[model samples]
Target: MPFALYLLGLAVFAMGTSEFMLSGLIPDIASDLRVSVPAAGALTSAFAAGMIVGAPLTAALSMRWPRRRALLAFLVSFLLLHVLGAVTTSFEVLLATRFAGAVANAGFLAVAVATAAAMAPPEAKGRATSILLGGVTLACVAGVPAGAVLGTMWGWRSAFWAVALLSVPAVVAVLRSVPATPAPTGGGGGARREARALRDPRLLMLLVLAALVNGATFCTFTYLAPLATSVGGIAPGWVPGLLVLFGLGSFAGVTAAGRLADTRPRPLLAAGGVALVAGWAVLGAAAGSPVAVAVLVLTQGALSFAVGSTLVSQVLYAATQAPTLAGSFATAAFNVGAAAGPWLGGITIGAGLGYRSPVWVSASLVAAALAVAATAHVTGRGPTSPDASRLQQTLP
Candidate 1:
């Protein structure tokens, strides 16, 4: 991979670490900041709220700017946002800081995807995108864990300090390596292409499917630790180790997406949805057995994330126009699902159900996502089996 591409990937890695490490440090943060844990919880939700609103919104507003300037400015925004978060005094200030951080985070992803695709050889786009996204899996595998340790050692502030430090080099590298690209034109092929993409009903269906699966996954995943420790008989020491296993599975899936994303997406996406159903089923059944729970969680992470690379490609390729809009909008749809999943999971857990209750409910959610995904192919409205050589053929 080109050095520039890797830099973009590292930026993503830093963002991913900053985003995910919050979960591991929430208690420490609450204790140090003298806030209720529930209040700390709201901070995470607030950040997700920022991503939901910021992804497409930020991209749309920045459409007229040169891509390089847009990217660098956002990197600077990311640095300032986290630095503020690290130094905040009042709980409210920290919350606001994290919200800004999320906006920067989402904007970065939207731009990075476009940047990676633009940077790639037409045929190598899949690989370029995969490398970009791998930074995310890297965060999961190592960054979050490291941050967790940092938080345990020095405090939650140090974790933010770590993110601030890591991001400096990433911003510098992106500025050094990524080439200049023209501001997105308001007319020409891009406009026409965007219009065409919007005409696809399958894309809408895929969005719905994503929302459902994300809801299910987050519902279960967000509460997994408490469940495993309280009811699944897992030792407390095993939590991060088990999470590491899940991350390994997630990384493997992401790496595999580069090859599979190019060859075909509909089958892979659908298959992943089906695998999600199976994985959730395993979780619900194995909740009481530590070994079984670990195995199921690993399977869940592996199977569900296997299509990470393909999901974006499918959305982008679903229409021939406005790739930037399509890409960012797809990211928006994902945020919607993410937002809904946690809400629904919270409701389920709040209803006097044990941690295991959400597992089955989550399975049902994944099942719905799978059904919609399969329906997309059946109705000819979702991701199709892309023939890399058949671009000249008329799209249905």
Candidate 2:
């Protein structure tokens, strides 16, 4: 892989850390701001909301600009927003900063995926995407925990400051390593072009697939801390360690999936879906068993991310006519799922279903995605080989 790909991953790491660290800081934020925990938790929802809007909006706005310049602009905004977050005194100000930061993060991610796809050999596009997204999984493994520790020792603001500092190096890396490529020619109005590109049924199916799969994963993931403590009878102190284990599994899954993505994405997708369903089932059944909970967290994380990168690759392949917009839509779809999962899980908990209820909810969503994948395969609309897709796109 190119060094630029790794730099993109580093950029993702900074963004992912900022995006996720808020979960750990909610309690502190609630206390410091004199608000309810749920209100502080809304900060997370605010960020996701920003992402849902920003991805497509940014993609459309930047459609005519060089990818490198768009990416750099987004990073500059991202860095500044984190600084704003660090300095904000009022909860409302902090929430606004989080939303702004997410907008920048969404733009950065959408462009990064498109740029990575453009940079890689067609045969290696999947691996290239994996390399770029690996930063996210790495954040889960390393950055979130470290931010939590930093926040606990100093203050929540410290974590934002750290992310701001991290973005400085990421900006430098992109300026040095990533080349500026001109936007594609023969463009109609950007909005019309993107709208027309989204008309493809295969692309739409892939977007739905992204949403369902991501929703399934987050349904369980958003409640893991409570489930670990209340259901598995684990100590609260052990929650962070369990999250690290989950991250390690995710890292391993994405790495392995990248190796097979170019040639065997369909099988990989099917297998990942099945594995996720099975993992959730086992987790629900063994919710009270600490050993089983630990094992299943790791298993679920691996299966979830294995499906994630493959889904992104499939969307990119299907959206050859509008790669950047497709990338934005995929990001938006994933955030939609991310936001929906926790809300649904919260409803289940409110209705008196135990914390383990999220496991079943996730399983059902993944099963739906599996059914869609099967339908696509049976109907001959599954992702094509990269070489074949390129040939088809080139034909008059």
Candidate 3:
């Protein structure tokens, strides 16, 4: 793999940190801004909303720009937005900055995936893509906690300042390391091409699968604190440790998936889906057992992330003409699932279903994803194309 791949991963780390660090800062932000916690929480929703709108829109607009230039622009935008977010005293200003930051984040990720795919050999595309995405998993394992600690020790603004400072190096790295590559051909009709790519059954199926898989994971994850305390009988103090276990599992899973994806992607995806379903089912039944719940949380995290790199690789494969746009769509789908999972889980809890109900809800979501994966396999379609090898050689 090229060193630039790791730099791209570094960029993603900064973005992922910005995306998740807000979770830890919300209480402080609410306290300082004199807003309700729920209102502070809406900032997260605003960021997701920006991502959902920005991904496809940015990808489409930047379709004609050089990959390296586009990436640098996005990184700079991300860095500045974090600075803006850090200095803002008004909650409304912070919210707007976060939304803009998310747009930059989405643009950066879409281009990064496309660039990685273009640079790797056909057989190693999955591994290459995973290398870039590993930063996000690493952020979950390390960055979020660190941000929370920073916020606790200093103030919420300190966390944002840290992210802004971290992003400076990422911007410099991208400008220095990433090589310029020409945009894909067919610029005049890029929008039409991307729109048509959305109509492909295989691409659509993959997007749906991506959404469901992410949704299933977040459904349980969003309520992990409550479940751990109320159902598993675990002490509040142990919850963070359990979350660390889950993050570590996710890091390991994505790493291993990158290696297996090239040789056995179908089986790998299928197994991940099955494992998620089984993990959730077991957790739902054994919710009262701390050991069982702990083990299942780790298992679910591994299975959930194991397939993430492959999902991006498949999107690139399926939408050969519109790879970046397809990738943006996948990002949007994941966000949609992320949003929906929590909403649905909240409904289940509101209806007097026990905290454990999220386990079943997540299981059903993954089960649906598994069914879609099966259908995709039966259709005998794959992401590979005759031009893939040639494109890899041409990438910077």
Candidate 4:
């Protein structure tokens, strides 16, 4: 809705590019740094580690700073870290920079979600979040592939350099466009007060739902390459196109949630959950059919992101008691899912389960998420439900 939200999305695009593009650069990095591919892969794990730990910690630490100041500080830190990562010759230095850059990125994302919510009307929060997260979808669509191409043509370090260069405009735009809201009111009491918000069952349930939905998404997504090539019989060259298709579907799904999530969160989640379960089951059954897999990938991607993005907004609303830390809760929830999903998928594949096993894993997670949504809806216990106001009053 606001121009500032788009600028925040722009910044997210740069950071998200760095987050995902590393997958494409791992081989080059391992060879250049004289490390094993597995070691280079640890760079991704380091970034995920930063996201999980950094989101809440950085949000609490910066809770008393002016919003715009914290944002700019994080942005500058991200840019500098990318530059450091780009120039580093040692594998350890690059690894450290990746972790630190993720910390900065996590902080910026937490603040950006809060700031985006603050800038929009209460009713438009979902739309604002979708707008912000659109950058991530865009990164998956364009940035990751571009980085891969750059890595192939030039070097892996050039991908890092590109992230640094792209962040410059985002930094400049955020400084110029984002409003400098004063620090949140709680001051030194920030962390304690935010921790209390977690005591609400409604908030906790929403956070768990967020984790489950995203876990399903990443579980299937992380192994899409092997799934396409080995199971669907698609040529390796066509894998990138399939990824783009998934990204496009994700963008569409989030856009739909932007329109409906505020008014119809439960219904949307229920419908999306059911669709995802059926989709994943079909995908698993049809894994050998290239056409079926392609279609399912597009549809499944849409359902995953639509449900995932809705949960993000819902988590923020559920943590209304801790406005400043609401984004942090959301950040931690999704990152936890992101980290666990791929790990579970890896375990399934490593155990001699075919690639289709991850599809079943995704389906199981989505089914669990559906049950959670149904329970919340039936009992009228969801934080955004009409009775939640009365329920909040009953809580200590």
Model 3, 252-336: lDDT tens digits are 8889988866666677887777887888999999989999988887878788888766777777777776766866887888888
TM-score of 4: 0.96
CA lDDT scores, all candidates in order: 0.76, 0.87, 0.83, 0.88
Which of the two, 1 or 2, has more lDDT?
A: 2
- Candidate 3 at 201: error in angstroms? 0.7
Instruction: Compare candidates 1 and 4 on lDDT and give the better one.
Output: 4
Q: Write the per-residue lDDT of candidate 1 for residues 182-223, one digit (tens) a residue.
A: 888873455455656656677777667656766776777788
| Candidates sorted by TM-score, best first | 2, 4, 3, 1
Model 4 scores worst on lDDT over the 10 consecutive residues at 383-392
Best by lDDT: 4
| Lowest-sum lDDT 10-residue window in model 2 | 386-395
Model 4 over residues 1-396: C-alpha lDDT tens digits? 789999999999999899989867898999999999988999999999999998998998888899999999999999999999989899999999988999999999999999998998876677888998899999988999899999999999899999999999999999999987788877768778887999988888899898988888889988999999999999988988888888888889998998877777777887888999999999989999999988988898889889888888888777778888889899899989999988999999999998999889999988887788778768776636333334445647
Instruction: Report RMSD (Å) for each prediction in the order shown.
Output: 3.0, 3.0, 3.5, 3.6
- TM-scores of the candidates in the order shown: 0.93, 0.96, 0.94, 0.96
Clashing pairs in 2: none
Alpha-carbon error at 250 in model 2, in Å? 0.9
Error of 1 at 208 (Å): 1.8
Candidate order (lDDT): 4, 2, 3, 1
Local accuracy of candidate 2 as per-residue lDDT tens digits, 1-396:
888999999999999888888868999999988999999999999999999999988877778788889999999999998898788789999989888889989999998998998889877778987897799999999999999999999989899999999999999999999997787554447656766878887888888888998998888888999999999999999999988988888888889888877777777888788988888988999999999999988888888988998888888888887877777988999999999988888899999998999889999898998898789889887755666455446657
